[model samples]
Target chain A: MRRSALVVDDSRVVRKAARRMLEGFGFSVREAEDGEQALIACRAEALPNVVLLDWNMPVMDGITFLRAARAEFGADRPPIVLCTTESEFSRIVEALQAGAQEYIMKPFDATILGGKLAQIGLLDAAEVPA
Target chain B: MSGSSPDTFAAIAGLVKARAGIVLTPDKGYMLDTRLAAILRRGNFASLAALAQALRDPRGEPLVRDVVEALTTNESSFFRDGKPFEHVKRILPALHAARPAGARLRIWSAACSTGQEAYSLALLLADQLPALAGRQVDILGTDLSREVVERAREGVFSQFEVQRGLPVQMLVKHFIQEGGKWRIKPALRAMCRFEERNLLGEHRGLGGFDLIFCRNVLIYFDTPTKAKVLAALAAQLAPDGALYLGGAETVLGLTDRLVPLPGERGVYGPAPALARSA
Candidate 1:
């Protein structure tokens, strides 16, 4: 089965890039301008397998969405991977505490996104390209 | 493993300096045993004494190369320090503007261990300078160690090696994980070339470079050796070329051939005569 992902970020460029890379890796990716849309997508009947959550976003930032998701969805929520920059170390720690499965630095490449998927067992190691 | 006497250590250090410019102090003698253990065992030398004696022979040239490779430190990573790379990204547009239309850019990563620094430069160029996508941007990675040169050519790195300095995105896009190691894909590897070279020796054919990264490795040399190496590097740089060094390194009180870029610590451009002329 093809996995699905929700890419939550304020930047249209980041969303487009992430969507392309996810599609390349055989994942159906949905973009959200901010955390509000991410929460809505997650609560939808067909929940994504993963969420690539950017720390900074307009209309409910990523952390708020994470906390909200955990509160509403409980442990049945999809694995959330925090997208952050080196300067956001404290935010990353907080995100992890709030139930993020993994984190990757900003300006991320497909290799890193793929690694995160494999890390959380969303992408099988055997399915990875040689 | 047999104990290496003080004389044995000194002799080994001398041989290493003669082949490669790296200076080994008496205090660093302890490091030889740990670093050169593989060489000693592989070469079937009974002790450091035997290796030293063998180095005295004319046929020991190849062995000397191996010894030099063994002694030199190959510790490196992709964008090891973030500051220099940040500077590279910021200065690149200006550097490009200063040159003639469609001018080719040549970058040198001196003592580039396993080619991480050179590859990092390539990645940055690819990401930032979309204008130069079809231009000739050659990144040369040279080291005194043959093993690392070969390894750099192979573009394979372990998980722990990739974990340092490299962001996860770059790791995934530029490399392919094969079992336990990650090998750089052809696209990234194509932007770089690796070679075994002694910085203290002649390198005329390589010609001048537009940017040079001689970071971190120079601290291994003594003051005099550092000056000589800096002079050589200055000679190899294009008139407007920029040089990046480690945070701990400086050209002040060493040589005036290169001057620091204003407000850009650890980055140097050639002195005014050459830089201003260009």
Candidate 2:
């Protein structure tokens, strides 16, 4: 089965870029413009195995969504990767502490993104195309 | 604010730094209050001052340890950043080529919380290094917390745990869906081992490693502790091996035993001293 991912960001370009990147890596991608929409989508459908969350979204920020998701799903929540431009080390630490499984700084290459997914055991070697 | 005293806070801070090499800031007073409130209430202490007195007593040894554990952050997950594993994959063939016949290749995931980091490496090795399928490859994961180690050994994860950094097909292939949780497949689980070992304590008999990922764990240590741990890690590194630290961490001024390898960001090579000696 093709793995599914929910790409949540405020920017259309980022969402489109991430969707393309995830699809190229064999993921069936879903898009949300903001954290509020992402949360609604999560509760409305079968949750995606992973969520690529953006930190600075309007209406609901990544941190608020993270807390809410943890509350809703408890320990069963999907893995959330915070996709942000925040380069401060303290903020990265804060995100990890707040239950983000991983943090990927913005402007990431697709190959690097695949490797991150693979490192977390999300991408099996057999699954990747030759 | 009942019973809070500067002396008590100072003593606790000193002990924590001495034991774990963490620097406790004044701002952490809130953290102390929040974490230690339960213990204070249980002991019938009305103030931090009373709790401090108890901590000074001979019977407070275990309490101190608990306080340290409570304050010490152990946040982590498998395959923390994506690029490092990409680097691992790119370098694996060369690493395999350099190995001597019959020599076992080992990898260590220091501060491996809940086993994700170590298991991630094992899965990657199993998938990419075909020659290692039946070979003796040791993947060891160690953490300072017994609680986290126990969780890692179980090889069970909540949907959330498996979701983070995990892809769908791999989830289906490498993990078994059991109720609301996911369990790692036996074949993948068998490739890795987990233990509880303090980075500051005596070195466990972990044999030499081809790659050592001592990532975010080192950021907590002060300079002296970081230097000591780096030296110890270097001692267990193969001459041509690599070490991966957190993105924010570097060995530049800490030790000359680890020289940065070009084209590999956040990775350091064994110092020339060890390379020449080997």
Best by lDDT: 1
lDDT of each: 0.81, 0.78
Alpha carbon deviation, residue B20, candidate 2 (Å): 1.7
Local accuracy of candidate 1 as per-residue lDDT tens digits, B1-278: 33678889888888877777778888887778888788889889898888789888998788888788878888886766566888888877777777777778899999998888998898888787685546668899999888899999999987656755565556655777776577888977888999988888876689999899999877888888889889889889987788999878998888888999999978998997764356
Q: Write the per-residue lDDT of candidate 2 for residues A40-81, one digit (tens) a residue.
A: 999898889889989998999988998899888765368888
Write candidate 2's Cα lDDT for B40-104 as tens digits: 77778887777767777887888777767766777665556667888888877777778777777
Question: What DockQ does candidate 1 have relative to the true complex?
Answer: 0.04
Residue pairs with clashing backbones, model 1: A109-B169, A111-B172, A111-B173, A112-B168
Q: Candidate 1: give its CA RMSD in angstroms.
A: 12.8
Question: Model 2, chain B: what is the TM-score?
Answer: 0.89
